[model samples]
Target: MKTKIVLLPLDERPCNYLFPQKLFLHDDIDIVLPEKLGDKKIPAGLKEIDSFLTKECKDATGLVISLDTLLYGGLVPSRIHNETEDKLKERLHILKDIRKANPKLIIYAFNIIMRCPSYSSSDEEPDYYEEYGREIHEIGAAMHKSHLGMENTLPLDEIIEKVPEKYLNDYISRRKVNKALNLASLELVKENIVDALVVPQDDSCKYGYAAIDQRDIRKAIIKNCLEDKVLMYPGADEVELTLISRMINTLKGRKPKIYLKYATEAAKSIIPLYEGNMLSGTLKYHVLSAGCQLTEAYEMADIIMAVTAPAGNMEEAINQPSKYPEYYAERNIAEMFDFIKDRLSEGKIVTIADNAYANGGDLQIVRFLNANNLLMEVDGYAGWNTSANTVGTAIAEAVDAYHFGTTERHQNFLGLRYIEDLGFCSMIRQKVVERLPEYGMNYFDVRDKEGKISELVKAELEEFIKNELSSISNNLKILKLIMPWRRMFEVDIDVKYIK
Candidate 1:
């Protein structure tokens, strides 16, 4: 009999659903994803997804779901749609029904602590966000501080002084409605409808309205004595994979023992922009969240993780190396070498989180690993978006690899990780963007700014990716690079194994 799981994702992003499905694909395990309601489509899509769940998945060993998917259709829909407050609460019935139908089945679900957009951008936000977004975000930050009994550096009068009164009112109104809905989900935990809950704060900062709401939710969790089962932290994209890992652990009746080594001690405190708290705390939370344990002694580790950070204070945002001082940070690179070699030689399954840069991998780290022929020795690697994104994703995949993985599939996955993080994003994306102006196009032409990149630009990126990733591995071929959403914040790789 197969160990089955039904996963409802936050959105249709390939990374959110497809990657985890692939990683959990074993002869004995089955991961099922229901059809999605198109982005921004609400009640109808939600009904369809729920109906599918009711009809299709009954005997699965566990279910991993996103409340955002059920209530709002997708994560973005949760933000942009104008669903009424009462109607939103009505949807919790679907989960209650699932629980009634399968009383003994384990359920894992996640709810997002919605993001506060930084700029006035309607791309992923509501229409008015393009103008008052920054002010609205700051207001939340100031309000968060006040709730915590901390001094607000910026007075509320000054924070929203420039915004139109109507926009501020509407924004606050929306936040209140959403916050109410999030709180209501806590009741589901009290009712024992969900076995575990993940509330990852999207686009978090030290202080904000979202942070303040998280405090309230944290109190509720404690009040219910559901603290161990509900995992809330500062992350967004990678929670599905993390929970699936935990689900797998539950099914297997085992915890993954892991060891962690960072490039520098400061690497532990370097707060990647979108999260609150230090990097070290987030990592420990992630490990336990995945039903994995961190070992005090390296000898006991089933897997070893080497987290790479910049040697000095530098952010790896752009490809222009000279624009930032400490570009390579050779000191950190040397440290990573010793770390990886030390662990790998000890027969520990090693994974790398090359966070020396953000929005892409550290080229210098990849360059060193490639030059020294240590790239293939590692079990997994992830260098996408923020530190939590990379760390959560890399750790889940690495833990899975340590327990259940094949050489061919693992190599193919690692190749895909490097191809995206290093080959395209770190290097080729900038190259192709540079060529866009020749076609009267710009970087925004291929990125999330405007919807659906031009076919010409897409074609150009495909050609460049082939050149960069063609020789990545003998076992995996560069099948295709796709913009699943037709914009380039994230791309999907169609990897075909060598026959």
Candidate 2:
């Protein structure tokens, strides 16, 4: 049987839509992502997405969709859009039509519990974020703490007492709109319009809108007896991947056995920045959420996950190693590597979840893999923006390995991971940040004075990226290196040899 899974991503970002499709590209299963809405922009792609579903989604075996895309055009527009409640509700009714069309499809839809970023940059949020972003988060956090019955909940009181009433009302009104939409989604799940639904709080903190949103969603889920089908948690981008993985395994009659390992014991307790929980807790949630079980005995596992994380607070590593001492610390990786080396030799798939430092992989670890010629030995490698990002993608790769892993394809995937995670994020990005100053622009604000960004860094990026990739992949061709977000924060590299 040919398994078809249609994905309606929150946006055209590679992580959001591309990674899941890549993971689903095995022998019997096919992952189909509808044509991206626009040229990676927002508020205009809904017609195209709807057209694809109306035309091409008939035979799909399963669907993993983002409601943000269906209603508000994309995730970004969901936050910044000025549409009214009546308009949003009218769009929400489309789910009923979709269900009437494909009643038998195993539908797992998700909606993000909107986030209040620490610093409002408008890069992906509303325009008022720059001046009032932090304050808004602080106010939400304070209210959240009080709801939790915490004693030190003075911040909320202070904000309510001090801040302008208009700004506070504006923030509250927007959150109210989002919360209503989330409930409407849960209603869809309740009515069997969708099989399962997730409401993940993106960029969460302890006492903020994220906490409050989770609390409300949890109440609704329990009230409606929808615990088995509806879920609420602290995650954003990885939710789609988790849902896809679950559906894939359920359809295939397989529950992947994963052996999880951490870089250091200390790393488990310390939460990486931009997340809500400890690294250990987050990994546990993702493992089970993906319909995979964690195992203690390494020998019985289908995939060995060796997570590389910081010994202390994880941060972006600059050239100075002494400042980030965790990078230099020998966390007994030698023994771990040897164990993995033995497993690979014995035909077990070994994968690395490199959270050694957020936003990049540890150069020490990358260099270690390169020097020992273990690049090909490791079945998969993922070190991207966050530990959740790395772990989720690596899990998808491991599941793919269990079903469709090949030596050529395995090395090809690793080739792309190393070039992007190791080359661009850690090495080339730093070089670009340093070089940008000479051009009279700050590293963080590298866009032109007119807010336009140039692809001038491709020439400089290709030199080092190609040199490093040559050391790793002989057959793989580095087709292009372009910055998707126009900053050094992320890269969108194209490789032709993977398929």
Best by TM-score: 1
The candidate that achieves the highest lDDT relative to the unseen native structure: 1
Query: Per-residue lDDT for 386-487 in model 1, tens only?
Result: 877888888877877867863566666777777777766776666666766665655434544233344433465455445543444455566655656544
Any idea what lDDT model 2 has?
0.74
Q: Please give the distance, in angstroms, between residue 90's alpha carbon in candidate 2 and its true position after superposition.
A: 3.6
List lDDT for all candidates, in order: 0.75, 0.74
Model 2 misplacement above 4 A: 39-41, 151-157, 160-164, 319-330, 407-410, 437-456, 459-470, 497-499
Task: Give the TM-score of each candidate.
Answer: 0.91, 0.89
Error of 2 at 445 (Å): 6.7
Clashing pairs in 1: 120-130, 140-209, 141-208
Over 164-224, each residue of candidate 2 has an lDDT whose tens digit, in order, gives 7786677678778888889889888878888888777677776688778777888989999
